[model samples]
Target: MSGPAPIHVVVVGSGLAGYGVLRELRKLAPDATLTLVTADDGHFYSKPALSTALAKGKHADTLVTTPAAKMAAQLRLDLRAGRGVEALDAGERVLLTTGGPIPYDKLVLAMGADPVKVTIEGEGATRARPVNNLDDYRAFRENLPNGARVLVMGGGLVGSEFANDLSGAGYKAVVVDMLSHPLAQLVPQQVGDAIRDALAAQGVEWHLGRKVVSLDRADAATIATLDDGTRIEADAVLSAVGLRPHIWLARDAGLETARGIKVDATGRTSDPHIYAIGDCAEYPRGLAAYVTPIMAAARAIAPSALGTPTEIRFPPLSVQVKTTAYPVVLLPAPIGVKGGWRKVSDGSDGLKYLFEDETGRTRGYVLTGSLCEERMDMDRSLSAAEAEREAA
Candidate 1:
């Protein structure tokens, strides 16, 4: 006479979503068998800090707050690091990995996004570095010497942050982008100009309204040729164009996907037994890449996947830009809303603006400079429905 086997849960990722669900699941089902599988070393670090790390003088190993061994022991989990999923067998409720087949009663997919890849025709085309993880950041830091001239592609948030960080640390950072303004996709023109000016005052060279067409090696330095017929020489090159979710794995396994894996408010995918979260999940509005949304998803997923129905909550949260040269906090207006941003106030250090819709309703807002302290008050003024509708 043997007792019944414990329920097993398998998670395919080692990022915030995977660890988040496990931390919450342990609170609900302490005795449930838990396992975590990842292709990397499974070290825990703040992914957002990678852009601003140069000013703080943090190495790759220094960025890791906890290692795989510690996380597994603390949660009493079976940790499978340095392993990748070759294929997913949804019909049989099993995962095909490099090690072997792993059957599970429930599965969680927390696969994060990858940098959008673009090809450039040149000999040094292989020199474009994108730091999306600890290992990537480690290599980036090791390759650059103090005061080295670095060429940065894209004027988005990540790119701007890195430019500010590098310039603040005495690195000669030159930025090239097709957009005429900084953060053209996220912020208003006023805010974008403010970011550009602030970083420019910090020694960051800007080549806006232009893009690198090709990269070639020149002795010890790399030469980046611009479409505007300008060639910039630098010791290193970095790319931060955009991010794309990991949707192929789910799509190939016969799961619904659009932009990212489609999931309900409770984080449940097309298959009830499997749930998706983080950058890889597409909510009703869009993919919420910020921290607060993913934490809420994990909380609901832990209970919902364990036979309990729990809906995730999307509160009005403010996204703060980590650039030290300029301070920014914003909540973008909802998509398809007939609205325009109007400058409200100008302070000594920054400016404040509000997004008003056609009907004169306040839809969203962005605050810069000294007015950034009003973020919490402004954030609460917006409704949850409109706030959660932020662009992916």
Candidate 2:
């Protein structure tokens, strides 16, 4: 009997997730032909660098040089740029795109996510900006003048980091968030306090517990009006509230979506032959919009895509890892791991917060700076929590 024909895989989106899937497919199935389709200019680089671009004294072009064409050449694959997927016909195994229809033995949705848009009134409101991709960052870099006054419209991870970075670079930054504290939902109260203090020390202003009602464009400045009728002025405004997964294609294709393209633990979507990963996927356990989980999802899905029999599960620990200039490191308390925290300060440079369940079993931890010295040992011991309980 003849061997089956080599499988052809189509990966949508050219972000980290899509690139990751393609890289893994190359590793696992060298014989397979892979096609990467992207809507934007497919530049290969780390998205995390956006946070520190200004502080690093770098321009957006410095972030990436190898475009999709070069990456495809290096990987020996077909790359379609500026071609967004229109829909997916799962039953027929066809991918409908703006350019044309493409067939694939397997499909991976790594479409990534879009930055959330805020609703406000005023002239500047119509001109408000958001940075979702390298192009957007380039625009931001070009528009920023020396000592430009900037108003960030959120206090979440993206917002806080932007504030810190821009402020450190000598740009006047003010963060406005309706939340009680910075990174309130993502971090514990104590961690949030430390982050707020750090940013404050860097000359970043905060308008906690306030919402923007509207924005008006002045001759050379933008005026932002708060809900309480307070007004503030800035040269530019950035909205980093949150991200919405790019799920319109999946939804139009009749795939299920909940905050994102719903997928199982191994990145398998509702349609077994189709898979999703990275910021676009909502895993069975939870959605983790970070590079680490994306790598895990890619590794798990690659084998399955290649007709290999394998089962994979995400590590119990899921989180958004951030590398900040303060030299900050954090593994956000995992979802649904209810517990209390005990903090120990090694010095001004390090602080460790341990989360334990009622039984005193280590469930999660957050370490900053030098405190991360204990990370390896803590991770090893925490991994034993399951075996330790089973043995008990």
Candidate 3:
């Protein structure tokens, strides 16, 4: 009798999450057939590096580590670049793409998220650019002239990083956010204040507790009107508000979705044959958008996608804030947990803060500047604390 055909795995997306899954799957089943379909050029590039590329003097073109053709050949994948999956038929196990319908034994949705755009009125509102992907970064770089004044909206991680990069690149960066301080959601007020001071010293102007209501065209520049009637002139505007997961694909296909495509610990969707990972997948905890989570999910889901069931267990992960002026490491406290940040240490070099719950359990920690060295120890403590809570 002839041997059964090799199981085909179809991965939709070419981002770090999608490729990470493919890498893991290849290791588990070298002979299995794999295909990658992406809407973009399918080049391998670090999404995190985009925020710091300008400061490092790296061109947009150089950001792509590997082109699609080379990646496909290296990984033995059937790469389909620049094609979108218009519809997904879960019952039939078929994906309707720009090329044609493709069937697979297992399907992975790593579609990723889209940049959240804020609504602004006036003439130059549409001119506000968001550098979420490589293509967007290229266009932003091309339009940015020497000594351009950039108006950055949002004071979160991406916005702060871009502001610092812009300042380092010899551009005037004015950051506007409705929040009282930068990284309000990640760090305490004191920590945010310290970072704000450091970035300000590097020529990053802050417009805290304010929102850009409108954008109008000036002589050759753009005028941004704040909520408080303050007008600022800039050559360009960059929005780093946030990201909304691309869930229409999974939702339209009748898969359960909330903030993102709902998947179990094994990355399996409501339909067992289909799976989701990366920024697009929402686990029990929430959306794991960072690289570490993506890698962890990939390792766990690879076996399950290949017929061997495996569930992922996430460890305490630290989020590193990329502001060279004052490096920050944070382990965010669990949502809805009763806790308050207590100062552990504060010195000229840096500061440290610990989150303690009502039961006197250390839930999370934050370290900045030279204090970042204690990340490993702090992470261990956080894990131990969590374990203690679970046992109780």
Q: List the residue pairs that clash in candidate 1.
A: none
Residue 186 C-alpha lDDT in model 1: 74
Poorest 10 consecutive residues by lDDT, candidate 3: 381-390
Local distance difference test values of all predictions, in order = 0.88, 0.81, 0.92
| Candidate 3 or 1, higher lDDT | 3
Q: Candidate 3: which stretches are off by over 4 Å?
A: 385-392
Candidate 1, residues 23-68: lDDT per residue as tens digits? Answer: 9988899999999999999988889989988988988898999998
Candidate 1's C-alpha runs over 4 A off are: 1-3, 335-338, 383-392
What 10-residue stretch in candidate 2 is worst by lDDT? Answer: 316-325
lDDT score for candidate 3 against the true structure: 0.92
For residue 390, what is the lDDT in candidate 1? 50
Model 2 stretches astray by more than 4 angstroms: 1-4, 313-325, 344-349, 357-360, 386-392
Cα error, candidate 2, residue 224 (Å): 0.6
Give the alpha carbon lDDT tens digit for every residue of 77-188 in model 2.
8888889777788889999989999999989999889888878987688657887789889998898889999999999888988898898789999999999888787656
Best by TM-score: 3
| Candidate 3 residue pairs in backbone clash | none
